[model samples]
Target chain A: MSLSVRHILSVNDLTKKDCALILKTAQNMEEISERSVKKVPILRGKTILLCFFEPSTRTRTSFEIAAKRLSADAVNISSVGSSLSKGETLLDTAKNLEAMNPDILVVRHAQSGIPHLLAQAVDCPVINAGDGMHEHPTQALLDLMTILKVKKRIAGLHIAIIGDILHSRVALSNIILLKKMGAKVSLAGPASMIPLGIEQFGVPIFYDIRKVIPSADVIMMLRIQREREADSFFPSLREYSRFFGLNKETMKHAKKDVVILHPGPVNRGVEIAPEIADGEHSLILDQVTNGVAVRMALLYLLCGAKK
Target chain B: MAEQKLLMTEAQMDKAIHAMAEKVIEDGLSEAVLVGIKTRGVPLAHWLARRLAQITRKTPKVGELDINLYRDDLSEVAEQPIIHKTDIPFSVDNSGIILVDDVLYTGRTIRAALDALIDFGRPKFVRLAVLVDRGWRELPIQAEYVGLTIKTKIDEVVKVMLEECDGKNEVLLKEHFSKRT
Candidate 1:
């Protein structure tokens, strides 16, 4: 098989064969991730650049950790400290970075399709960390790894993704992967917050949480709209919590072994009740551990390090 | 070249597995456990447990161990070794353990498997079972119960195909030939 994937721009571009290869590679990478000497010399002479136009903690740190573990030099350029704030177009900034001959470029921007444009402008591989609400491919891959670690299989499973479906790139990417893996997915939230015509993704949509919680093998609660972004989406926090929040009582309807998940900076009682988030079935911390493995796999594959 | 014939058919393999289950029950083994060593061993262990259930009217716990990292020739064989999941839902402490595998050849894989098993917990007694044993022992280890034993030279490969995976049940030996110089 040819090992040539220069850019990872969206989840839709991943085929079932591609998915299997990545998952199998991630399974191998997990062994190296657990060791005390976690660094590898696979990309010892390579350089990876991270250009984040938006603020992030997990996505940025995870990519940096992944690059460093592969023994690759990483450069972090934030818009706040870079010359781009003084009116340099994204293309010009990318062109400048290209001059340094970095082997890989990981970019995150608030505008959708920015990474695709960057990939076109550069000769090296480009990875889209998150491009607006379009897609977050690595996060979705890590989530799949987490699910497989716990459930042992992904097909024929039911996963309920609740809260802020319209604003969450995580939910969008996850729905694509879960459906591709043969899992039945359902979206539950207020009608306004759920995107219209998403049934094309083959996910059933529900406005009531009570009706959907019973059949879920995995309940993934997305972060509620940030307080600053709430004014345009929801009327009040209390009403949203009452309608969609996952509480102890609401969890009883789910399968006994159902796992709870969240992409953090949680809204506490608003998106998911605190009890269930920290409860026995939650694989939240396991997802974080698998994030490193998945990112390592992504970098290795994109860097053509696969054997 | 030597011709290799079928020593055990699919029906005979099933019968031997059931007889092993009866032996496990007659031994008065309690808290019995079956641990398979990665890829092919996992399915064999599951099959043994199913037969054990039919004989004892109780299911023995099953676990899977991946010994990729513990392999003796890991660095020499592949640059990036593949690892599979190791799942043991129940503790192995004081349990009567049966280590299952599809085929036992040079026995180095079983040696690596033994080292991997100790990391989980100490079992009361560890026994070995194989569906087919091709005679070429690099170590002194032997299977307590074997479905069939095939005698072959170093220039042949024994292949076992199971219905659960390959949609058939048979054993074959393919002669290895070097290309003309």
Candidate 2:
């Protein structure tokens, strides 16, 4: 079956059934990695263009790998190397990329709604890799997949999202997806790190990480957005880690079998302690592995639909 | 809408399966690894394994292969092919592998399955087995073991309904007129 929506710009728009379909399909795609020949012929002869205006490591590489594994020709066009550097606007760049006739487009930009904008301008479907601090749907999906493998379920589970919620696209996407799947999500970070109006989303907020830790079945530690470091959400990294960082003491309060998740490039002792990040409870590596599978599923679904 | 005509009754199906089991036994069953193409082929593989066990008192390894990723007409098909797990726990490098399917038509699906199977490992030998071989093949592929041979037109559909998935045991032929026709 195909995805009902044309563009995956945000998790706010996906239904629970949509999420379930994607996760199931991703499980099937995960097997490709274990094969001696890690490639499929499903998307053969199709071209997938990756347009990234922002600097990224995992998301860009993950999408490219997923496309290639499916035997789809993957073309990367970053803002620096492309015509966008030659005085072309984002819209003009998108139109020119469309002229080449790519089957699906994966986009990442510094500003939010860029994928939404390109989806309207292009005939093919658009998958948002990460559009500012608005949402990173694929990251949330891979997190859910990882959690499912360990915890066996998402419904009725307490998930505490710690650190830099105010600027985390991962936290927002996870909150929306977890809520949709009937999971209890709470925010734990410094006061300034918690986004305002998040209470309207019906999730409780905790300034003290310890308070949220006891009931949390899953602890999702978010990276402190260092690029936005000039804002100074906390007094210093030293104070932030002491109060909100997930150390051995924090782990004691958490569920005995609690699973930890982080969406890449973690600031070791800032959002999470080194011991906890690399410890038995951590699924940090699994999240990265699942990212490729989740992307492959989305590409197959979107491209297979009536374009 | 079209009415279905019963091609094989429950007792007739048992006889057809027995014939298939005898053919596998004759073809060398000691090193056999039965791999079912996903959806209907899975149960067909299990049934053959059980029957083979009854005769030779040895149960062969049964595996499931999903050919969705290897389909030749993936982009041209209207609906997206749903992917399923392709789990072959045993080694395929040097074993007699029998590819099982419920109904064989067009021969393209078997061609796709062959492409998917080879990626797992190099098999000692590979053979094709089908419960029904409807003769309208688009490719040169042929099944080594067949339970029943039926002539079919382009507008007809051959459906094998079993208890494990479809809650019945019978073979039916129906006329299905879609946009393709």
Candidate 3:
């Protein structure tokens, strides 16, 4: 089949076929990772613009690397360093960059649906690196890639996403992708932090981590309460960690071979215990490596490399 | 036995290749690598890479690949007794890889080549180059660097004869008949 992707504004924008193509392409890209001189020239003349309105160390750098590996010239535009400081509107800035005729625009905005709006305005393909608390499609894709590499299949796997569901785009995107891939999903967090209507996504919800930890094949821990304390989302970090964190005692309830995932900048002793994050079941580092592959697949498909 | 009539003469092939080389240079073919899809494509890749080196003052890395295992029709087609050698010495990662082929027929070969190429390393980019794109594609395939696009009927067969195999370089169209019919 021809590989053509116009825009990737949301995780929902991807169909099962698109997902399969990306996964298959990623599998192929993985071989390059094993080689000594890792690189490809599939996008020699293409230009990719990385426009970030928020601060990010991982997503921004990963995308830049991915684009460079594809042989595309990548230009980074952070809100702090760019003309946005001069009071340029998001649309105006986007149009200014669009005038340069970049083949793809990799954008991360603080507001949800900004990437969608930018995609509608520009002729070039737009990739959502992250958008507010709504979704992080690429992160989810990489996470799925990591899971697929480890487990081999997504269908019927019981995955539990623990902590801060209300504020995590990663959590939301993971739930959508996992559910679509036929995995049974469950959310565990403090009742105050879990969104009210999330049950409509067809996954079960739980307030007590102990109740659901045993049945989970994959335990994905979100960043702790203190991570969101800057926004005043939680009152006390210690109390939150005591109740919802993945400690040694709570882990005893989990299956022997349960895989653990965390979207990093991980809180050392807060949401996830150190042992679990660095333990036998940890697939965290693999997720980072897979991020490049998944992004490469996305760029290739978006750039019409499949023909 | 019917005699083989030349479809593309040596002069025509040279002229087309010269034009292709010029376009590659104009399109900034620096840091480019040529990867041929097995058997016939290997010679074409070497030939183009040599030409590109002559023009650019840099010899592009040339790699030969066999995509038999990656073919989509492996399940349908009867197994072949022997497989060809595949050798890609340099990393394709982050480099511009030009996939060279002699003829673009059903596109199944290109599909298999793609699967095989990705197994080595992801190039920074990939583009297709075909000496002859004879129309009868069963899959969606197009050549980015096309030497010629020949329009032919479903029953007609376009044969590519390189000096490495045939005595001279040329392309020929052959007609075949079934004895049972």
Candidate 4:
């Protein structure tokens, strides 16, 4: 009942109970979207700052919409137009925003742990929209909400995460969260793209996507982050697409009711086929829709905790 | 330590619900729909719905409302308000609604419920019913149907437990005891 946890920086910071509570609260938040008048007055007097150091369309817009739907004032500050471009430090930028009296600071940065450092520097609450290759906690939470909505449960399910695991914060957050909730998690991709010591996380590593697909209840396809890659992890995107990318052949290996998920800006032919991305099995857009509700729950929970 | 107080027993609460059901008939609300405030109010609403069905031979529509998002004192209540489901399957347009709850305290909850109910649709008229009415009315609100009325200090807690939820049917009063210095 305390709900004293003020920041959502990583899925690693959440317990199983915390996860369940969030899912339940998000279920409540989803009801507001179904109403004719979707806006709520809970956050009418509150101001939220969306500070992004990296470029984004979906996550940023989803957070903005979530804040607006909650009747909170949402202001977007990107690095391209901000003082960070003028050689200002993250602390200085954050301190300045704190001076403006924002109730919540939702941050996305290219460098991991910036949100954490900002949370420590500011008195108000901080929610990690995404921090580098570290974790996208809200993405993971919305993924959970989507899976729970589609499959009705998370425990005792085979959830296969495919593609670019090393560079994907979505993959890492989902892996930790699914494992915590008693799901069987498996990661498969080009061998070079698989992070070392990932086996220590207790999920099986598979080189062949075909081997993991037949047993997977939920197939989560992670986007190939080419911008973040310093060196090529594969011979070519075509070969990687043919072998590991989910296509018609790979779909044959999956279960009849397998739910396919992708944290998007998807490489239509690389990580997932265009058909599967838009098919009945896809929860990609559901994940996007649930993202707003999950974020609304996070903002409501975290900001309400502030003195 | 403060001694515990029992306000109502299971059978007494059942009789009270029947009486409230009869009050609905007396008020010419045979076509009325019941909307429960979330958590405790939900079970009480269903209980009253069943009682009304027996009294009128027609089951009233039932719904659940969660007022967390409409609450004015969410910051004062808890660090984070635990939001639950707000489900009203039937339309509220031009229909009479009897908002049901377990305990009516400061009337702020009823006020919030009123705000939340409006978001669905405009109702012809909305009425209030509660299992208990412990007075500390911060807002100008009063229940039309109340099972029991108890006077108590501000620090005392009133709890209504339904068998559907808490595995019992009883009303309890617990006085808060501050730690000795």
**Which candidate has the top score in lDDT?**
4
In order of listing, the candidates' clash counts read 0, 0, 22, 0
TM-score of predicted structure 3: 0.68
lDDT tens per residue, model 2, A148-257: 98888999999999889988889999999999999999998899988889988889999998899988899999898889772387788898888988899878888888
Instruction: Give i-RMS (Å) per prediction.
Output: 6.4, 1.1, 10.7, 1.5
Tens digit per residue, CA lDDT, model 1, A25-45: 778767556544566555567
Per-candidate alpha-carbon RMSD to the true structure: 8.3, 1.7, 12.2, 2.7
Please give the CA lDDT of all the candidate structures. 0.81, 0.89, 0.81, 0.90
- Residue A137 CA displacement from its true place in model 4, Å: 1.4
Q: Is candidate 1 or candidate 2 better by TM-score?
A: 2
Residue ranges of candidate 4 with Cα displaced over 4 Å = A229-231, B4-6, B150-157, B172-181
Error of 2 at A289 (Å): 1.0
The CA lDDT at B61 in model 3 is 88
Which pairs clash inside model 2? none
Write down the lDDT that model 1 would get: 0.81
Kindly report which residue pairs in candidate 4 clash with one another.
none
The reply for model 1, stretches above 4 Å from the true place, is A1-4, A305-307, B1-181
